[model samples]
Structure formats: structure tokens, C-alpha cells
Target: MAGSDIKQSLRKLDFPLCARDALYQIEKLCTRPGKQMELQIDLMSEFVFGEIERRRKRNVPAAIQELQLIEVQSDFFQSPGGIPAVRNALFLSLYPAGSPRYKILGNLVSLAITIHNKAVLNAAGIWMQQLGSTSQESVGLARHILNDYFVLTSKSVDRLQQLPILTPHFTANLLTAIGEVYKDKNPPTEVLRLIGEWINDNPSLLLTSLMDNPALPTGGIPMTPITPIAGLFRWCILSPVRTAAEGSTQNEDEQKLYSKIQHLLMDSVLRLKSSGSNKHAISAQHLAATTRALTLVLQSFSNIEPTSRDLAMERLAQAVSSAMSANCIYGNKQELLLLLQSLSYQHFLIEWTLQTYSTKAV
Candidate 1:
């Protein structure tokens, strides 16, 4: 069928048929090699989206199904040229949060991860931002998507390692998404374990990415080097691992993972402290990010035994004191003072609590 005829037919049909025929024609045209074919594909996309909007209130399921089919069956939506339309269609179909079609939205997210295309990853990031505002009915679907995301990325560590080259925004988007999931009161342990394993395998990549504030827009990106720090700190503070029953012991693997992260955090602080030379000056942003990350590291030690936690705190305190003594030529002194004051308050509370318990024992 000619492109014009397909467009006209799509306009006349209702719901699923309009979407189904539009996808079929888009697929067919996408395979052809020419500028004219490209133009035709674009035309079909417009018609498909228009029909989606026209029928959305009347038949959201069909529109959502069309997006899911396109995402699953073809790479067109994953390609750079088609991402915007695909993204728009997906967003438009997500409504009346009570709809049972959220599972399909979750599947679409999984498909995007499977495609591992940068454009699609961005679209998925956008979807996640939208999904956050949805009702409780969507939580299960959101969790499913998070689990799938972790599983997929865990299986593709090498691919993820090369993400900066293959898909520049993938790492950022993935980290942002993980940070979002961690916002929940009880994030899935499986997801957390997978993240720890991935970090264990690629500590440098993950840490450096987390620390480096990319120049991308923050609209859909949730992990901004500083924002996630507080969430992570809260995770450490609330984790049962921090206040296990007396004599409870962590598995050897878990201990090692925690130890590795601790080492990485210290290493990061050392790097930040030693970064500037006479010829160069560290920026305020870098200083703030490094400081916040260090604070998070200290909070994370709450998961360790009391003795280990005390020792880690002592070492961290000394390091912070030394860094402050140097009077690094970056960031406002008042900001640094506030950070130190905050740390001091947390340390005092911990110490006071320990002393009280010791006195009670005596």
C-alpha cells in the first residue's frame, strides 16, 4: 500500500487496528533504504501518534498495546530517529493510573533495557519519571521494572562498562533509576545485592560516574551526585545490618563487599583532597560532591559492628580534619564548616549513645 493510503486508512480505523496497521506499515517502510522511505516513515509516525491521541480516552489499552508491540518487535523505536515519537506515545498512553495496563508499561520498560539503545534508555528514564507520580497500583509494576533493570545490567557488566562509548547516557540513566528505586522504604534486597555485585566488579566506573556531575539536564535524572547521598545515608542508617542482634555475624561475602565499598569511599576522599595543583583549582561543585560522598561513606559504616564503626569514624574524622587543615582552594569555607558541623553532630550523638550504654553496663 502507498504511504498516503496507509495514513488515510489509519485515520479512519479505530484503536488497535489503527495502531496495528500503522506499526506494520512503519516497519515495512523502515526496512527500505532511501531518503523517500525515511520521509514516509516519519509521516506514518505522525499518523500513528495522532490516532493514539484521538483514541486514548476511548481505548488506552489498544494504544498501550501498540507501543508495547512496537517496542518489542522492532528496533525502530529504539533508534535515534524514532525515539521522540515512541517516547511521546508511551507517555500519552500512561493515564488513569487505576488502569490495569501498567503491566504493559512495565514490559515496555524491560524492552527498552533489552534494546540497550541510548535513545530508548532516555525514553525509559522519562517513563520512570512519569511512573513516579502514579498511584500505589503501579508500585508492583515499578518494582518489576527495577528488578529487570538490575538483572539485565548485572548480566551485561562488560556492556555496561562500555556504556560511556556505546550509549553515553545509559550509565547516568541507570544510576538515576537505581537511586529512584532506593527512595522506597524497603527497596528489594535482590536489587541491592545485584548493585553491590556490579559495584564490586566495576567499582571505579560506578564510583566515578556517581561522582562526576554530567552536564545533562536533570529533568529525568534523579542521581545528581549530591541528591542520592542523603538517600544512601538514610539506607545505611535504617538498615538492620547496622543494628543486628548481639553476636550476629555477616556472611564473609557481605563483609568483603562492605569492606570494598569502604575502601573505595576512602580512596575517593583521598583523590578529592589531593586533586588540586598550583596550576589548577578544584571547583566548588567537585568539593561539595566529594564531601557529601564522604559523609555517605561514614553513614554507611553504621552497618558494621560497633568496634569497626568506631574505628572507621576515628579514621574518617582524622581525614576530614586534615583535609580541612589544608584549606583547599575550592568551595566556600562556610559550606565546609557546615558539613563538618553536621558530621560532628552525628559523631557526638553516636559517641554519647555508646557512652550511655557503656555506663549502663558498668
Candidate 2:
């Protein structure tokens, strides 16, 4: 329907729901073919933005998210004796973080960024952090926020830190995604700084990553989400960090930040190799991640650091060699040999060890 026609139909309906149903109908319209939507997109977008902004008159980051704060849809959360606000009802009922209607928020966030709207940018971290939001919701918002942050100059780097505390699963995925996004090139100081901060905040973050879930009431094992650790390794070791971010003020020593990140990655590797208990043991899938990270770490160190190169090599070799023993119990010898053989091209050591280990296992 035409914009005017849609409005006329809405006018014919009852009070609060009339406004809501109008927005809902627009939400449905958005999912149709893009070419057809060109006519109505602007009209619908303007209506949603204008109506919400006018009703809330939000002037600050906190105020911008006032609508989201009302998690439930009810009269108690609305204005007294005024036209009942539809935002709470719309957000809670009509649209969830996963539904097609959720795209509206993504659109609004993009437009806000294009115009340099600082308050809305900060508000994203807050509203997206609402507890009980599943990994799907957090990842959706985080991808948009991080992707946008990539285009920002270093002067606005502080905005990266303002992202509220995310769940561990979300954080893990974010770290891995960062690696892929920058896979083809060197990461700048701004990106490195963000990675370092995340590593510092999460203790034993990588070491415990691949373990299983806790036992259930029926006595099942306690578990953590099982995901490929290769991405984490790539995020940490495959890429080099620049001495400084492009166009940065050169105020802080970014190379030092890189060192901190390397140290954290190395420590996590050590934890994985040294801890012999069931809690630290890896399953068959984790071997791929471990091999890739180990290969990249040794390779990356040869290029990135000089002073600790020999010592890191020594400690890592002994620890990893011990982890690879038949009695190690993390993964069986057959799996390890096969995994190493597949990764033989990663390093000369892998090729040589795979040949020798294959002989022994056979």
C-alpha cells in the first residue's frame, strides 16, 4: 500500500494500538523485496524515528535506551493518562532480538553512525547488554558495533571500551570474528588494544575454552560451549600488529600493548599443556585448534620478539611434548598423529614429528 493509504487506514483504527499496529505493519513491509521497499522505507523509517524521538525526547545515552529499559509491555510502564507508549510493547512483543523486526534497530544504528550521533553509539553497548539475552542476540548487536568501530579513527577508540560486559560465549565469538575480519592484513594498534583489553579481563579464558559442559541432574558432565579454537589462535598469533594505529596521536606505546597480548596468549598455551586434570583436558576437536595455535605462536614469535624467543621456545616445547605423550589422556595418540599429519605444512617440526609419531602409533 501507498504511504498515505497506510496512514489513512491507521487513522481509522483505535488509539494506542493504532500507532503500534502501524509500526507493526511497517515492520512487515520491510521484509518484502528491497526494490519495492524503496518507496516506503523512508516514509516508514521517518515515522518510527519521529514518533519515538518525539515521545521520549531522549537527550543522553541513558535516555536513548529508556524505551528498552521497559522490558515488559504494560500500562504501569507508560505515561500517566497520556496516549499509551507503544515502544515497550513493540520491542517486547512484536520484535525480538532475532526476528525480522530486529533489523529496524540495525538500520537505526547505521544511520546514527553515518551522522556522527555519539549518544546513540554509546547507548548501543548498554541496551545490547540486557541480561538473559542469548548468544544470538549479543552476537548480532556486537557484530554491528564492532564492524562500525572498524571505520572510526583512533581518536574515537575509547568508544570501543564502552561496550558493556558481554557473556563469555559472546566474548569468545567476538575475539574469533576479529581475527577473520582482519585475516588478510595486519591489525592496527586500535584493534590490538581492544584485543589486549579483552584478554586481560578474562582469566584462563582460552585454556578452558574447549572443555565439556557440567554433568546434568541425571549426572551428565558439566560443560562449556564446545567450539573450534582455531579462530582464537588466529586472532592471537597469525597476524602481526603494527607499531601504531594509522592516523593515531602516538600518545601510548602500542608495541608494549602487543607484548601484553602475546604474553597472555603464551600463558594460556602453558595452562593448557601443564594442567593434567580432567578439567584441563581437551577432546578430539580441540586438537585442531591447539595444533594451529601452537604452529602460529612459534612462527609469530620468530618474527615479533627477540629477547624472550629462546625461553618461550624452550618452555613451550617441553610443555607441549609432555601434553603429547601417550599417557596425556586429553586426546588419544591416533587422533593426535592424524591431526599433526594434516597440519604438516604448518611447520617443519610438524612434518618431522608427524612422520616419527605416525611410525610409533602404527
Candidate 3:
């Protein structure tokens, strides 16, 4: 009869009931023995939030302080085994995993924040480790929960980038999600390796996409060193040198062939600068542009070059130091300065020994 009466009273009570009465009821339920702890917990949370809203409406400091205190206490309260009776009851009745009030659902934002926190990364890592296990049913459940959490959170990519264990999963997931978001009709790669393959297979397409901007004005081949051209040139120069050292080619014949290719590039640069074939001239121009840009960048290579024995080294050092202080490396600023000082002094002396053998014409 009392239970029926209580239910009737609860139904009759207006939502957002009198704050004083609500607070009193909530507090009493929280303190009383044999009370349904879940009801108390949920009611308390709601009441506290209500009080916070009320205070915020009135600009009440007391209400703000109370809300902050509640948040702080609740952080610790939500830990494992704080109030299992209340937690279990709430988890089942209101806050079930998918339920709006379930602890997992209720604190989705908080869980994401915890997942990203460096101090708590290990804890999250444990959760991920447990999730990745094949034998555990909880693993699949936890993985789904985390995947949802990551998808919803704004900091998902940043968090995943920071977490080494999640890097592979996040990269794969992000590419798919990005493709969907942009409606990328043809998505690129499942992994970074696959990205390299795509680039290798479709180099001209990659170049065209990058260079197709209206800002580029593709009426004729651009005379100016554009970013796309410069990037390709830099990669071409650096890639072979870095990759083709010892085990790069299949056999000695291939190595010798590549070595001849290297001599050809340098020879072409010199010949282009002197004789000025359109393609080779453009190549030389790019080299000059790059040297001008990177003369100052070479300061980062201070350990590689020493000033003790070489006068050329000392002059180069001074030019680099001046460029560093000025913060300009491009457009012949550092290059001209270095050339006027160190390079102008070097005299070129070339000698070639030619051996000729007379052979009968075939």
C-alpha cells in the first residue's frame, strides 16, 4: 500500500520539483539504509546537475562550487567497486551499456578523455590488450565500445597517433572513415606501404592532381620552380642515392649501370648549364634553385663539416652563420653570399686522358 502511495506521489510530483524538496529527498535517499542505491545515485546526479543549472541561471557561486565538488567526488566514485549495489542497479536499470544512463554511455566523453591521457594510456592499453584477445568475449565487446568511442570523439586521430599500439588500427580506420566522409569514390591505401605502391604505379596521375590547381596556370611548362616540380626533382635526386648504395641493385652489372646513370645526371647538369638544351636547362635551373634554398639548410649539417684544415670550410661556415641569423635561405641569398666568399676562389682544372685503339670497320 505504501509502495503504491509512493509511486502515486512520484507520478504527481512535477518534473524539476522544488529544489529544496528535491535536494532533501535526494540526500535522504543517499544517506538512508536499505534505500535502492541506484535510484539514489541517479537522482543525486540529476539533482546536482539541476542545482548547478539553477545556480548558473541565478549566477550562484554556492551552486557552482557544489557542482564542481560533485564532479570531483564522482570521478573517484565511478572507479571500480565504489558502490556496486548502486552501480549494478543503475547499470541494469538505467545505464546499461547502450542505455543512455549506463555508466559507459553516461561517461562516454570522460572515457575518451581517459583513453587519450598519457598517464592513463597504460590503463587504456590494458583495455585494448584485453579487447584484442581472441578467447575473451569481453574483448569483442570492449573493441566495439572503443571503436564507437573513438569515432564519436573529436580527438580520436590525435589520441590514436599518440598511442603506438593503436597506430595501425587507427590509420586503417581513419583512411576508410576519411574516404567515406569525403565520399572519395576510390580510396587509396589500407596501409602506408600500399600508399607508396599507388604513388609508384600512378606517378603521372599524382603529379597531375597536385599540379592541376587553377593557381598553377598550365598553358605552357612553367618556367618558375613550382612546388610539384621541385618536390619531384628533389625526390629523384635523393631517392636513388639513399636506396642504391650496396644491396640496392640485383648484381654488379646493374650497380655499374646505375653508377653510369649517376655520372650522366651530373654531366647533363654541367652540359645543360653550358649548352642550354631545354630539358637539361630546366634541370640545371632546378639544381641552382635547390642549392640556393639549401645552402643555409646545410647549417643543420655542422657536425658533418669541420673548419680546422679547410679554408673553404671556414668561409662556408661564416656564410651559413650569417644566413641563420637572417632567417633567409632561398632565392640565391645564401648561395650568392657563399659563392662570392668561398666558391669564387676555387679554380677549375680539368684533364682527360684518352686511349684510342684502331679497329677494322664491320
Candidate 4:
């Protein structure tokens, strides 16, 4: 009878507020001098979050309500592993793998961005990384987000690009989402175009999945000097999406769109590497990363036009020479050496790259 009464009381309580207060009090108690032991703090935290998780399962409607309410409350997600329990519960209940509530995701994502809550964004990013890989819900969510930017059209860069949160915090997860969405079928040109625009906007899109990526866009493609993040541009733009059969209109459009993506990426790399002479403009890491990225992009397409290929290789050689003259080989020489070694297969780069490669550390 008391258990039944507990359920009745839980349904009526302001669980989000109560949970927040509970966390705040626990923090105080744990921090008070001589009030708690070191291990005790962790134990208390786990107990509190564990109970919250259980309560969410027992009353999902209440969990969903808390999910919305917690967003407005300051310091709600501050407690480590404290608030994500509620988030996970709500997502599982509201967005089941089979049948998710699509309409709710936009407002949730948009609100998350509008409020500019770092904790909330981080939680969402990590959550997607964990569950999004196999979940059907993630694929649908990706489509919904992508659709908001570009519709299925062959003509247009004329529309306003309303990409709010383009950070790898969310975009990295899109890798999994993209995989699930187009696992079996050919990639649509519209999607390729949408991502190309994103590459132009997000400079460090590849740096994460680094501890987490830590961007908005106004106009030109900003140079991405950071290595892994620049590599991310290479990964997404050159992703091996399924292609349509040859001679078909679908194949032609997809290839044309993909070529544009490649060019955009190549240009970004070229700009950053060329900037290697301006130590203020680019880093030692820049030339190494960009050189490797361009090589990988070059290798991916066997049929890349000779003119473009030759021009790219020639530009790369100049950039390397310029960067070397600027002493790019001194710093990050270990990393630079590894990258150059990896590119030995690209014999066109073998000339200066093989004989000219030097390390300060050596």
C-alpha cells in the first residue's frame, strides 16, 4: 500500500525542481569540511542519480516533463552524471528506436542551441555517440536536421543557410547518422551539397569524436589549421557514399556535386598550407595535416582529371617548400615525420617529400 502511495506522490511532485535541489544539497554536504569522506561523495552522487534513473523508468511521463523543465533551470546539468540520467530516460521513452517523435526533436535541438548551454550540448553529443550508431531514431533525427537546411532540389545556393550548431559536437555524430541513413542506397546530391556548405562553415569539424570539438559561419571558408579537424573535412567530403549506376542522371548529378565538395575541401587545404609561412596564420601541424588530407583526397578518385591532379600536386610541392623554408619541419617533427612517411606511396610527392623531409628533434 505504501509503494502504491509512493507512485501517487511521485506523479504529483515537481520532480525536476526536487531533483535539482537534491543535487545542490548533495554538493554542499560533500564539500563541507569534515562532513563527508572522499569516497562517500561519489557514493552519495551515484545513489542520487541511480534513484533518479529508477524514478524516470517508473514514471516516464514525469521524466518527459522533467526533461523540458530542467532545460530552463540554471546549474541543472552541472552535476556530473547527475542530469543525463533524466535525459537518457526521456529519450528512450519519447524517442524509441522503432517509432520516435520527430516533431519534438527540432525544438529540443533549437532550444538547446538558443540557450547556449554547454553542458546540454555536450550531453547531447556524447549521448548520440553512444546510442546513435545502431539506433533507427538517430538516422531519422539526422534526416530531419539536414532537411531544415536544404530541400531536395538541383538548383540553388540562393537560400539562407540557417545552420545554428555546426560544431563537431553535433556534426561528428552525423557521421554515424549519415551512415545509417544511406547505408544501402546512393547518397543524394542534396545531402552532399548540404555537407559541403557545412565544411565551408565548420573549421574544426574533424578535431572531435580530440576530447570533443569546440563554431558559427558568416562568409568565406575559414582556414582550418588544426590537423584532425581539417582531416574531418577530408573525411566527410570524401566519404565513400554509395553511387548510382553509370550513364544515369543520378550518377552524373552525384558525381558533379561530389566534385564540388572535393574542390571546396582542396581549396581550404590549399589556403591553410599556403599560409604556413605566416606562423601567425598557420601552424607546423597545418602543412603536415593538409598535405596528408590532399593526398588522401587525390588517391580516392582514380579518374580525377589530370589537370586538376597535376595542379594539386604541384601546389602541394610549393607549399611544402615554402613551409620548410619557414622552418615548419622544426616543430611537431615527430608527427610531421609520421605523416610524410605515410605519404611515401604517393610518388609524385616523393621527390622533395622523400629527400627533403627533415626533423629538428633528429
Candidate 5:
């Protein structure tokens, strides 16, 4: 069929059917090898973009479904030049939040991450930034995307680094997402290595940015949100001291790497504890998140050597205790107590295990 005929048909039909047909045609065109079909692909993309815009407000749900199909099912977005236009179309259609359409948008975001195409990532990043501005729901979804999909490897980092605009807020959110992933029991070691390298490269800048938010409305006192910092420490503590092989000592290089990460984590925890002195700056939510993160960090020490684990537990305990004492004005006392109780129980188990092992050895 001719391009004009297809465009005419797209206008006549509803969004869902139009999108399906448009995607099918685009896919068929894309499958043909070489640039011979480039013009056809561009034309189909424009047609899809235009049709979606035309019907966006009137039938947003349908438009979103179409976008999802395009993102997941077609390679139209595989073209670098076409990415921005398609991305803008999706972003613009994502208005009037809290609609069922958001679920589809969330899936599209996931697909973009999975695709890992540079152009798509840029688009997804921009869309995330925009979503973050809208509401808590959108922000929550954004964090979910980060936690579930964003891989903290060199390539992913490079994509984020090369984004045309990596605003401070976006960077903070990105770090927070990484933190959530680190909260997992067995977050990838590559993620740890990447973050450790990043911390080492610019030790103060990222942490300072994370910790030094402007004063909240009530006072000029600076209150840093503890979630991201907590995630980092949780990840650090969870980092393996040795490989899976039992009784195998780490080589010199591995030992040095472990020591460096341990030091970085200790320094970060100390910084967080010191920040607690600004009690007026901290809030109930901040304190709760901080406590929760610290609890997780403390729990992660179960797999480490006796000396290193003891030192980590001590520093974490001191940090948590100091923060709680200074910021007693905020946080749920009961919740904090429970977390501490859990940590204490875990610590006891670890100690008991060590003592039992020592006695047996003797």
C-alpha cells in the first residue's frame, strides 16, 4: 500500500487498531536489510507519532497501548534519529496521572530499559525526570524501575553519564534507585565494583550532593535523606569478603579491594551519623528510612571475617545510636527498636557461631 493510503487509514481507525497496523507495517519495513527501506520506516514513524498525538487526549489509554507496542514490538525506535520524536510523543501523552494508562507507561519504561538502546535510554531518562515532577505515584514507579531494571554496570553508567542533561535531582534519584537494588540480599558484585570505583574517583562530590540538600521549610538546618546513603552502606556491608569457596583466603588484590571498600563504607557511615546533629533538619520520615537502612547494613555483616565484621558492626552501631540520640525528635521509636532488636539478635548469632567454631578448633 502507498504511504498516503496508510496514513489515511490510520486516521480513520481508532488508536488501538491503527497502532497495531502501523507497527505491523513498520516491522515489515524494518525487516528488509539495508537503508533501502529507511524512507519508508521514517514515514511510518511519523505517521504513528502524528496519529498518536491526534488521538492522545480523546483516547489516552489506547494511545498508550500503541506506544507500548511500538516500544516493545517494533524496531522503529532502534533508529537514533527517530528516538526523540517518538519519545516526546510518549511523554506528552502521559498526562493526567493516576489513570490506568500509567501501568502501561510503567511497562514501556521497563521495555526501554531492557532494550538498552542509547536513544531509548535518553528518552526514558527524560520521561522519568518528567514523571518525578508529577506526583508521589510517579516517583514510586520511577524508583521501582530503578530497583528492578537498572543495571549498575559500566555500560549503563556510561549511558547515564552521557545523557544530554543529567540534572542533580535526576542524579540523586538514580543513586537512590541504585541504593534500592543494593538493598537486595545478593546484588551483583559488578554493581558494587562500579559504585566503589565511582566513590573512589570523586569521593566527596556524590556523597555531598546526596547529603547536602537545602534546608526544609521549617528551618534553615540541612536535613539529608538517609535512603540513598543507607543503600550504599547496605551494599558495602553485603559485599563479599571472599568468594564462594569455603576456607579460601582472598588473594592480595582481592584483599586490597575489600579493604578499600570497607574504608569507604566506614567513612560514609560516620558522615551520616555526624549529619544527625542537625536534629531540627531531620524529620520522622528521614529518621525511619535511616534506621531501616542502618538495620539492613548491620545485618549484612554476617558473611564477613571476624575483625572486619566486628569493626563494621561497631561503626554501624555507633552511627545508628548517635543518629537516634540526636534525632530523637523524629522517627518511630517502636520501629527503630524492632530493627535494633533484629540487629542485636543477628549479631548474637554471628558471635555464637564464631565462638562455637573457635572452641571446636581448640
Candidate 6:
């Protein structure tokens, strides 16, 4: 086939893996170092730049169409060399460490997984490693896939229970993504097992991270409506802490850690309550995380008879309630109610119940 004819043919496939091998051989021939080689370079550069411009104009899916064009032409470039050349620009566009495109870039990772492109998928994983809270928006389905990939795509969460908490971002993302899987109407069992394993892996990281960064909100707070870890944290908060009440000789280290976590929760809620940027930008994900953490602290101490726990819960409740009041004032009632309802059922009720239980015990 002529060089132009070969290029046209390569531009036709949606996926690279599906193209015929013979076409690849012909494409290599088109690259022989001669007069036509210069023409080939110009043609390829024009195509790539044009694709980039088109993507800029129309949005990412259009960009995906162009990527498909690249895939068809993959034979023209050669696997590692050609594939990355075609992939680099789009990869750059999609995974900026702190860019606004972080969320959409995550969706693109999802699409890459859908196409079974392991190379691109791995690239996405590496990109995520460099991001921080800035990439929380990208932690939905893409997170599940990446987590699975890291765990060798484990069939059961219990099967991979020993994974370490590598980063706060990953920890936050995995927690919420698992929440999503469990919150789904059908409720995938794999998700529960996965979460069970995750909890086993680093039950303390969430608390520790929050204690260290009191400004951090709940995972997937405003970003997602249903977060499993948020629910789990709620469970932890409402449930009594046996270690505290059983006269089990509470470890000082554990106590201090828990106390710091509580302080962080209080701080986050206070930020939300103060009005302005923190409250105005308070997404559901952040609220969920904050509420859950605060609630956990409340529940852990509920087993004790000390007036201190009561005072702490009271202050935390006021902080959250104040935040909600401000949120409602600003007309962000959806999340305001979410926080309120969780507080009403999960945290406040526990305090009330604890009071009654303490009176009876005494």
C-alpha cells in the first residue's frame, strides 16, 4: 500500500489490539529513512496536533474518538514507541496533579479500563500516585479498578487483606469507592469483602490522618451521596467502645490518638460552621467524612461515665449543627440535611442513649 493509503487505513480502527499484524508490517515499511520519511513525520505530527486541537474544542469523548484513530494507526508507530507517542498528550491533559480536569481525567481512566488497555491503565495509576486531595473527584469507578489492579485484581477482598495504607488519597478513595459498591442497590458481596479487608489493612489511618490534618473533611463527602466508609464511621460512632468501659486498661497511645482524631473532627466542623469558603464549598463528601469522624469519637467515649465525653459530644454537636444552620442559610440544604439526619440518628441519639444508660448504671 502507498504511505498515504497505509496511514488512512491505520486511522480507521477504534482499538489498537484489534488491528491485523500485516498492516503493522506495512506501516513499518512506510517509515524507511528517505524522502518519504520526512513526509511521514510531518503527517504524523499534523495528525497528533490536530487531534489535540479537536479534543480541546469538543471535549474528551471527542478526544477519545481521536485516540481511537491513534490506536488504528498504532501499527505505524510500533508498540512501546508509537503507543506512548500517541498517548502522551492525552495523558497529560487528563491527569494534572491539581488541575480542574482531575474529575474528568478519572472518568477517562475508567474508559481506558473499559477498553482493556493495560498500558494506559498503568499510566493512570502512576498519575494518581502524584496527586493529593486535589484528585478526590477521580476516585469513583476508576478507583475500584485501580485498587483491584494493585491487588492483582483479587477475586475477594478477604483474599487480599494485607495491603498497606500507602497514601491518604488512596485511603480516602478506597474507603468511598467501597462505600459506593456496598451502597449500590444490588450490593456486590465482593465490595463488602473488599471493605472488610481495607478496614483490616489500616483501620487507624483514617483517624490518624484526620488528627494530623484537622482541616480534612470526610471522604467523598459532597462528591458522592453514598459513601460506605462514611456509614462505617457512623457505625463506629454510634456503637459503644468496649475498650473504654470494660476497665480494660485503655492504652495511653490509643487514647491520645483517639483524642487527636476527635480534635480534628471538631476543627473541621468548626471550619464548616464559621461561614465563607469552607462552608460555601463544603461538598457532601466532606460533610460525610467530618460527620462520620465526629460521630465515631462520640461513640467511642459513650461507654464512659465521665462528664467529659458528654461535654465533647455537646460541643461537636453544636459545631455540626451550626455548620448545618449556615449551610441551610446559604441554600445548600441537600447536604445540610444529610449531615443533620446522620447526626440526628447516628450521633445525637447515641449521646441521649448514653446519658440514660449512665444514669441507670450509676
TM-score of each predicted structure versus truth: 0.50, 0.43, 0.22, 0.42, 0.44, 0.33
lDDT agreement of model 4 with the native = 0.46
lDDT of residue 237 for candidate 2: 36
Say which candidate scores most in TM-score.
1
lDDT tens digits, residue span 21-66, model 3: 3344543453356555555554444443432342233444654544
How many residue pairs clash in each candidate at the backbone level? 0, 13, 2, 1, 0, 10
Task: Give the whole-model CA lDDT for all candidates, comma-separated.
Answer: 0.45, 0.43, 0.31, 0.46, 0.46, 0.40
Local distance difference test, candidate 2? 0.43
Worst 10 residues of 3 by lDDT: 349-358
Per-residue lDDT value at 49 in model 5: 42
Candidate 5 clashes between residue pairs 3 or more apart in a chain or in different chains: none
Model 6 scores worst on lDDT over the 10 consecutive residues at 214-223
lDDT by residue (tens digit), candidate 2, 1-362: 76678766765653334545545565455445542444344433333333334433345454343243221112222324321122222233333455564444554444444444433333332233231222455456545656566663435556545332433433443454454445434566677777777677774444333442311223223223432233333333333321111222223464467457656655555455445543333343444444445455555444434323333333332333433542232445576566566445644555665665555542
Off by over 4 Å in 6: 1-172, 184-190, 203-362
Q: What's the C-alpha lDDT at position 63 in model 1?
A: 54
Residue-level lDDT tens digits of model 6 in 64-161: 64565445533232345543322432243333444544434444444444444445543443343334233454344445454554455554433234
Candidates in descending lDDT order: 5, 4, 1, 2, 6, 3
How would you encode candidate 5's per-residue C-alpha lDDT over 15-105 as one tens digit per residue?
A: 4466556655654444444413554544444444433355554545655656655564335445544434433333433333454445555
Measured over all alpha carbons after superposition, the RMSD of each candidate to the real structure, in angstroms, is: 10.5, 11.5, 22.6, 10.5, 13.5, 14.4
